[model samples]
Target chain A: AQRVTQPEKLLSVFKGAPVELKCNYSYSGSPELFWYVQYSRQRLQLLLRHISRESIKGFTADLNKGETSFHLKKPFAQEEDSAMYYCALPPFLNAGNNRKLIWGLGTSLAVNP
Target chain B: NAGVTQTPKFRILKIGQSMTLQCTQDMNHNYMYWYRQDPGMGLKLIYYSVGAGITDKGEVPNGYNVSRSTTEDFPLRLELAAPSQTSVYFCASSYSLGGNEKLFFGSGTQLSVL
Candidate 1:
């Protein structure tokens, strides 16, 4: 079965420190990955996607086909960056062409000042 | 523009009651979905609709139902509510899927069943 894994349940970082949120997937074919973030009392929204390769709010994620991972990274973390991050993978072909996203158990990031 | 909107920000239900969670989008998206979020469980899709009048089951559709009778609305129905059904429900929409498409989500509805 296709699955997404976010190994860390919680991550803490000091302000201005580097941050990384790990995400791994198990799929036999090429996967379209997305990173979604939810701040305190806010709705979840898209942070970025591997296809765009665009840095939003100083965060970037690269898809590594060999490792089957798409980890989110940010340099010089800000205190406002604290949020719950989730990695999602859509295995369209594997699901008989059904468009559905498989989400990972999120990692809560707390950036301390 | 209001990307996506969900009604009843918070609701408390008694066992065996039934209610519909309303969701609507103004983006004219073709795909709509309903997902439930639980502590440490992430988001689990309950149902999805590719277009108006077409709906299908998702990974966790056992206790929920959905209908997309129009292009802009997709409502989720919970019949005979139970304590296990308590969750934070989110509504999302996208123009297309399996490509560079990204989902736009609503603020979510917090439902508690007693």
Candidate 2:
């Protein structure tokens, strides 16, 4: 079974400080990783995907096959960056046409000004 | 376009009550999903459908049922609602299941079982 683990329940950082949200997964085959963000009172939206390898809102995540990790990073955290971050792994195989996603226990980021 | 839209944005149900959460998408997406978001628990998949008339259970399917009778609508049904079921439910859709296809989510329906 594919499972996603996000170790931190809450992370606090000062404005302009660096932020890292750790995520690890357990999957046998090649996995597609994604970082989804939900700002206050807003719907969850895609921040970035590993396949794209492009940064969004100054945040980037690299998939490490050796370690089975895809950690989200930002050099300078802004107060507006505070939100709930979820790491997701969507299972594409054996879906039999009904594909779904496995999500981690999200991390609540609080960027203090 | 309206994208994915879920109706009855807020609802309160008593124990043993039943209700349906309606979801519709204007994107004509073939893949639609229903997920529940709990405090600190992220989002758990409740049900998903590849297309009209094909639905399957997901990570957390307990106490819920779904039907996709049309390509534009997927509704989630909750029978005998319980306090444990109280949470924000989101409806999403995607074009396909491969190659970095991102999901488009609705604002979400907040349900509370008293």
Q: What is residue A87's positional error in candidate 1, in angstroms?
A: 0.6
Lowest summed lDDT across 10 adjacent residues in model 1 chain A is found at A90-99
For candidate 1, state the interface root-mean-square deviation in angstroms to 1 decimal: 1.6
Q: What CA RMSD would candidate 2 show?
A: 1.7
Task: Chain A only: list TM-scores of all candidates.
Answer: 0.95, 0.95
- Chain B TM-score for the candidates in order: 0.97, 0.97
lDDT of 1 by residue, B1-114 (tens): 899999989999999999999999999999999999999999988998989999999888998888888999999999999999999999999998663478899999999999
How many residue pairs in model 1 have overlapping backbones? 0
Q: Name every residue pair that clashes in candidate 2.
A: none
**Which lDDT value does model 2 have at A110?**
99
Tell me which residue pairs clash in candidate 1.
none
TM-score of model number 1: 0.96
lDDT of 1 by residue, A1-113 (tens): 88899999999999999999999999867788999999999999999998788999999999999899999999999999999999998775646746788799999999999
Least accurate 10 contiguous residues by lDDT in model 1 chain B? B95-104
